[model samples]
Target: MQDRAEETRRAVLQAAAHLFFERGYAATSINDISERSGRTSGAIYFHYTNKEQLALAVVEAHFAAWPALVAHHEAALEPTLRKLVRLSFAVARAFRDDVLVRAGARLWAERRSIAVEMPPPFVDWIATVERMLTQARVEGDLAPHAEPSRDAPTLVAAFFGLHTLSDALDDRVLIEDRLADLWLLLLPGLQSCPAPRALLAEVGAAPRARRAAPTP
Candidate 1:
């Protein structure tokens, strides 16, 4: 009975996340989640009191998985600068590919309408980046003018701005490519000489070979 209930809850969360990602908070109704989950309204309501609660659950589940995602991608193995770059790519990939993360991001964007007093995942992201930037500064990887306190939020803002633009264009499938371009623009100011190409390779950022000119 407990296993069945847990399975039903997971199904509801999965369905709600998909609906929330596709329809946004205001447009996604509880009945919509129930229909998609293949569960009755009673089952959904047994777990969540309302749509707001369900949406928050989706967001919470998404954020809860992030640390494991980072570790799985080996973000901890690299130095701070490389770790930051790798994490940026990992997050971009997640936003592009993961439905739960997509739902969480959308929910946070619509938090004002939802009116729930939950913790924003962006705060944790910014804090993590700030710590990495500070570590990079201490290790002399950052430029003399680089200020971790200012740049950490700037970096996070730029990342989400890319996501917003990608959403507007309806082509988030290429977010990883966009993040690569962003890292190219950001690395010069953020890293010292050499830019740690070794660490970059671990994150799959190795530069492509130059193509030969086509014979006329």
Candidate 2:
């Protein structure tokens, strides 16, 4: 029974995430989630009290996924800066491919409409980047004039902005290219390494041909 209940809950969260991503908070409804999950309204209500609670669950689960991603790269045997670059690519891919991530991004953007307080976004991410930058500086990968405390927030903001623009422009199909552009422009200033391009290539951050526009 416990396993079945867990299955039901997962199904409901997955359904809610899809709706929340496709339709903003105000537009998404409990019935919509029920329909998507193919579970009865009562079943969904049994797992989540209301739409607000369900939304919170989806966002919380989304936030929960980051630590594991960070850990994966942290365990890797690579330069701190390389790990940082790889982490950004991983996040961009998540934003592009993960329904939960998409839902969380939209929910975060529309937080004002949510009656319950939502978890704050970007605080932990900024701190993570700062830690990586600090370690990179110690490892002699960071440029002499760079300060992790100051640069971390700016880098995080730029990353967030890049995804936002990609979402608005083409649903993030060009996100990797944009990230490559961003690194190409900033790496020289941020890294002490003699070859930023080589570093980007090592991490597979090279830009690719843009996807053709959809036929009207």
Candidate 3:
């Protein structure tokens, strides 16, 4: 019974995240979340006090999942360059499917320090990106000049820019198809030298985490 309840709660968070991504924080009402998740508002209230709380929890999950997301594109231990390129493609794919992520990008945009006050999930995403960029730099895949600590905001902006363009471009759905072309161009400006294996070794040597397999 406890497990079932926990499952329901997780479902609510995911549904809320999806809704939050599609609708702005103020615009996404509790009713919208309830309806989308196939649960009663009462049930939602059981897990979350209000839309704001739900939004925070939902964003929290997105941040926490960053490691898992980054791990997927790496199939080998010697292709950090390709991994970086693939990461770009993955970002494009995520923005395409996740409406909440799209909305959050706009809402929590790095315009000012004001964005720092966004829901937990938004803050988490920013931090996670900073961490990933830091890792990229350490692996020598990122240019020596790329300052993850001071310029993470810019890196996030570049990623979001790609997402925004992919959406606005009439040929956006096919964006990943031409990802290689863009990656090649980006490669020169970003990396001082190729260091694909460093990334693979890091990802591969890292402790493996066990997760519940997705339900059918």
Candidate 4:
């Protein structure tokens, strides 16, 4: 019974996530989830009390699987700056690849209630990358900073800049390709500087001369 219940829950989340991604959360109804999951509306309610609750479940799954995604992008690297860049691309790719995740994020943001205890997964994702930037700074991979740790926010800002800018182009692959250049633009004035070989190999590989576009 537990196994069946668990399977049903997973199915519901997967379906809801897809709908939320494609349709946007406010547009996604429980009826939509029901049809997508091949389960009845009662089954969905049986598993999750409401669509809001179901959205949370989808986010939980995204967070729980996050470490593995990080590992996949970073695994082959020898802890170089490129690996970090690859991880950034990996994250963007993950979000981009799964419309459900995108829709779910949209839904959550729309339904955003102060009453909910869940910290935004997007915020948490930024925090995780900030930790990485903090560590890299400590190791002298970034530019000099009075407080290298404080520079974590910059890392998040840079990624957001890249994501928003790249996404606007509608060709995220191109943005992923130019991540190294993006890092260079953002890394200046930081406390530690990563080695050029590492940076070039991992973070600075764009051959096309990029013209600066206005930040969104």
TM-score of each: 0.86, 0.95, 0.61, 0.74
Tens-place lDDT per residue, model 1, 71-106, is 654456556787778778777787888899888888
Ranked by TM-score from best down, the candidates are: 2, 1, 4, 3
Candidate 3 structure quality by residue, lDDT tens digits, 1-216: 899889879778767667655555666688887788888999889888776667656555544545676777554465454465556656666666665555445445531422234543334445655676676676766787767666556555656566567667843675554344444444465666744333324433211344889999
Task: Name the 10 consecutive residues with the lowest summed lDDT in model 1.
Answer: 69-78
Give the per-residue lDDT of model 4 (tens digit) for 1-216. 999999998888888888876776678889988999999999999988887788777766666667787666546645534566667766777767765556555555665541344545456656666666666655656555534346556677777667667766874667655566665565454425434434545444544555899899
Candidate 1 wrongly placed segments (more than 4 Å): 70-75, 194-202, 206-216
lDDT: which candidate is best? Answer: 2
- Residue pair clashes in candidate 2: none
* CA deviation > 4 Å runs, candidate 2: 209-216
**3 or 4, greater by lDDT:** 4
Model 3 regions lying over 4 Å from their true place = 71-75, 99-116, 119-156, 170-172, 177-181, 190-216
Worst 10 residues of 2 by lDDT: 190-199
Ranking by lDDT: 2, 1, 4, 3
What are the lDDT scores of the predictions, listed in order?
0.82, 0.92, 0.59, 0.66
TM-score winner between candidates 2 and 4:
2
- Minimum summed lDDT over a 10-residue window in model 4 is located at 189-198
| Of 1 and 4, the candidate ranking higher by TM-score | 1
